[model samples]
Target: MPLSLPERPIILTGDRPTGPLHLGHYVGSLRNRVALQSTHQQFLLLADAQALTDHMHDPAKVSRSILEIATDYLAVGIDPDSTTICLQSHLPALADLTLLYANVVTVARLERNPTIKDEIQARGFGRDIPAGFLCYPVAQAADITAFKATIVPVGEDQAPLIEQTNEIVRRINRQAGADVLPEAQALIPSVGRLPGIDGKAKMSKSQGNTIPLSATEDQIRDAVRRMFTDPLHIRAADPGRIEGNVVFTYLDAFDDDHAVVADLKDRYVSGGLGDSVVKKRLEDVLQAVVAPIRARRAALAHDPGHILEVIRRGTERARAITDTTQRDVRRALGLFTLH
Candidate 1:
């Protein structure tokens, strides 16, 4: 079996295992991955190899997070027995694929990648950016093509990354005079990207603005209490602006009470509703949303060994599929017998 795939197409998606997943992950992709598991052949990667591209000095952080990442996946209802949840480094084929892909792609193309540019600037790499960090998009292409992925679900900001993968696919197929590597399409999520508590564009772990998946109840409450709201909304009776409000944004993502959210927006926008009331509503929404996941994660935390076993078995299965693809890829490039 080529994993559980839909009659339509196969789906491939994953995250770098640099840290535990959070609410942003849940609202962004994890929930969708859970739904896709029964319909599409899904490969959920623990991208430690990719993590090393940036976290080269911190193997210990990556090591601790590997199992935490797995537990988050399980708690969020990713059926590991059905979907392949494996480490990126375990699949040797991906490394080989990356080497071949690197040759076809130029440094100029890598430099122009919007994602890499922002990453390099954010990391404050003055002139000495790591070669691995620069070449990671190619590695991601290898990750996708290693399993012959047809569909990759990602956020809107990642559209350029998928485009790079498609370019590599087309170039490799042209050079080989055959379509061995299928062009992968992106499935952009419908929701707007979640902002950090400070209203930053993204809720990143590094920015110290993320709510951890394993955060304690007190931590969650504190985070909520300090969540940034519209600066204009100072007094309870003041006419608050809801257009760029972070609390309303959280409510949009987490609160199931659409009518209530609508009412709150109107009241706040018009006048007399305080930010505290909206914040309290958001707290209720988040707590209701995360309670079960927290409970599930707590239960699984007791069986760390079992979780590792699941990851090991999934890695074994993923390698089998990637191996076949690698062999074919090498043959296409006339490198199988040579190396």
Candidate 2:
């Protein structure tokens, strides 16, 4: 089911333009983001600057993927008319706000962020973690406060980033003797993570287990055909394990026919159905699921200029709010030089 945000709060969420979005993004956020636009003032940031925080050495890759990322957002149901989609770099206010937020936060505090710790371990950036990577939480605080966003939808791994934003919000509000920024709240997803096709931890681009949103029909078919299944269930008569099985995970995510899925589960557990048969069903389900999305994406791909116009208009609206927030922040910091 798509997520719902409470009335009376602004929502801000976005993806870093490090790569094209994939199936995991659909399950995690994009699906709900599409639905939320009708009900709330949603800001979808194409966080190119944030991508550069880690991809400084690969500017070309970052530059190329921003268009791909925006395409993915449009392919899904993110209507630019209802949702404001903007480039992160276009908002110069975010960088200005980040500078002020950094002073309010301590170095020790930044180092202890759980998300940063995990990213550092995964990327093998021991002591050489970029200063930008370490200070990203402050940048994120600027992202939230720049738009006065009160609700931030994030996965569990991103909860620390939201907390960091709220901390700055409280600190800045108190320090200036004015409640200029509202404390941003983290709406953590109830489901923890989506496993990769390899049945490993989270689905990731570096892990080579993602099904790209822009993937062709043949590519999706081949990927699903190669999906991991229950290793212990070697023969048709062997009882299959449902828990931690990739096929069942996909079914839980995509298949709306719970009764049919239950029947398949029973067949597998009762030592009659083979793993091949179950895999075939999973393949069918996945194909049925993504076919319409692929078709819609193809239709939109025919008009690249139209897509860019949507983003251009969205960027303007986004800049309007950010411009006001930057003015207020400068006033608070005495950066404004008005006579």
Candidate 3:
């Protein structure tokens, strides 16, 4: 039988369990997830399997970071009651679905994926890209379709993955003459990239430019102090440029008072506003945001067993849903008799 669509849209989104979550995650997707949980049937995945595509050599790191990532989620107010938080590896059906979908997509199509291309270049994998890494998009398609997620929240860089996922869905539906998989739409957040303290375009842990959610006041202060600003503005009276200023960018994203931020920007562009003053304001704003989260994470860290229980429960619930999808997929492909 063909799978039926849900009355309320299902949202599927998650993070790779490589390390602790950071400000980039908060501005990009974490805030949106907290807000959308009430309105949609949401499933948040801890994509350890996806993380392994790149970190295959460090299996222990991936294993150890699973609970840490889950703690970050809970710390940021992702209620387990409202959101089903599932680990990717726990759901065997996703792998089965990936295997089935692999034959439908061509190598040329995978190579054309803009996100994959960018990642390959960023990782400097000139010609030695792992087959597993190359095929992760197909697995991601399985992740979305298995849950029948209508909305998949992602960054701008990942928009192409959603497109490729829908293409596979359409191809399979046309070939099987059944809507075995539902297409997912990408929910790209407005505040996409949070520039690193070093003024890099993106903040990543590997780049040594992330402010983790659990950072202390001292750490936050240190990061803000070293934030990149206009090099030309050596003197306090020198006119500054805000175009590529990472400090101002952080203010624009984090500071709630629009009028205050606008006034600061005016002063910054005109001169007389020192980088220290701006950095102080940024530090204050960031502390206000990260303080509560840090407190929550610290409190949660004391009860590792409870966090593990949450993952176990969510995995059980998610497996039931994916199991049904797998059974339907098997029937559609005539792998087994539909009893």
Candidate 4:
């Protein structure tokens, strides 16, 4: 039997257990998750199943990161008592809904999705894209609707997935002639996307440019030292451009003192601040931010049993909610259930 949902706005947001979540994940979504868990019913899905879309050959890595990312969440102050942290593979209804949704969205429509196109090109899959990779948006739709998630926190690049989820919701609701699934809204964080230290691309695990949640003090300082700044600003008196400077960008994202960041930016642009000075400030800030999280992650890593227990309990709770939705969706579509 399925459990009943709490009477509140339900939020479903998570990360693929592909790697240790980085500052990008924190700035983009994790911070918001921590805040929303207090006001909304939240579920953090360690997306092991979805991670398999690109990592089918490395299932072990996917399984391993489940614990790593769950620890990341806990270290970042995501209270397991507040947020239900579930493993995606343990939720059978998600796969069932994915199969059902696959029939709703056309292949051409999937090909036309901008997010899907960008990912395929970035991965260099060309014409030989994996079927699972191509159909992940459908899978995401299932994950969202199965929990009846009304709000899905995501980055700007992922807004298309929420739209696609709504399209599926409309399709299913039409078949059922009622609102069986609530469409989810993409709540983009104010910080947007955090770029890598090189300013080449977004901070990503695959790009090897990420500062992990468990990054060491030395690693944090080193990453900040190498952060991209204006090449033209060769000396302390040379005017530096903050337009593409990754340092200011991170400062803006992480540093709480807006006035100080503005002053630094002004000095940088007015030909007085050196890159080292700016980098030093950023390094200190990042060190402070990452030190506590690193310690918490280290402590959590020592207790693998505690991590497993958290995932186990959350998965069980999530199964009930998703199972209830699955049965409702089945009934709405007029599919006969084995009662």
Best lDDT among the predictions, by candidate number: 3
Clashing pairs in 3: none
Q: Give the whole-model CA lDDT for all candidates, comma-separated.
A: 0.88, 0.84, 0.92, 0.91
The lDDT of model 3 is: 0.92
- TM-score per candidate, chains pooled: 0.96, 0.94, 0.97, 0.97
Residue-wise C-alpha lDDT for candidate 2, range 1-339, written one tens digit per residue: 122334656999999888878888888888888888888889999899999889999988888877777888887888888888898998888888899789999989998999988998989999998999999999999999998898899998899999888888888877777777778888776555788988998899879999888777788778877788888888899998899888888888777899999999999898889877877887787777677777878888788787778778888899889988888867775675463
Task: Write down the TM-score for model 1.
Answer: 0.96
Model 1 CA deviation exceeding 4 Å by range: 1-8
> Each candidate: RMSD to true structure?
2.4, 3.7, 1.3, 2.2
Expressed as tens digits, the lDDT of each residue in 1-339 for candidate 4 is 233446888999998998889999888888888888989999999998899899999999998888889999999999999999999999999999999999999999999999999999999999999999999999999999999998998888889989999999999998888878888899988886999988976998998988998888888888988888888889999888988889999999999989999999999899988898888988888888889888888989899999999999999999999998999999988999984
- 46-72: candidate 1 lDDT, tens digit per residue: 999999988999989998999999999
Return whichever of 1 and 2 wins on TM-score. Answer: 1
Off by over 4 Å in 3: 1-3, 337-339
Give the range where candidate 3 is weakest over 10 consecutive residues by summed lDDT: 330-339
User: Model 4 shows how many backbone clashes?
Assistant: 0
lDDT of 1 at 51: 94
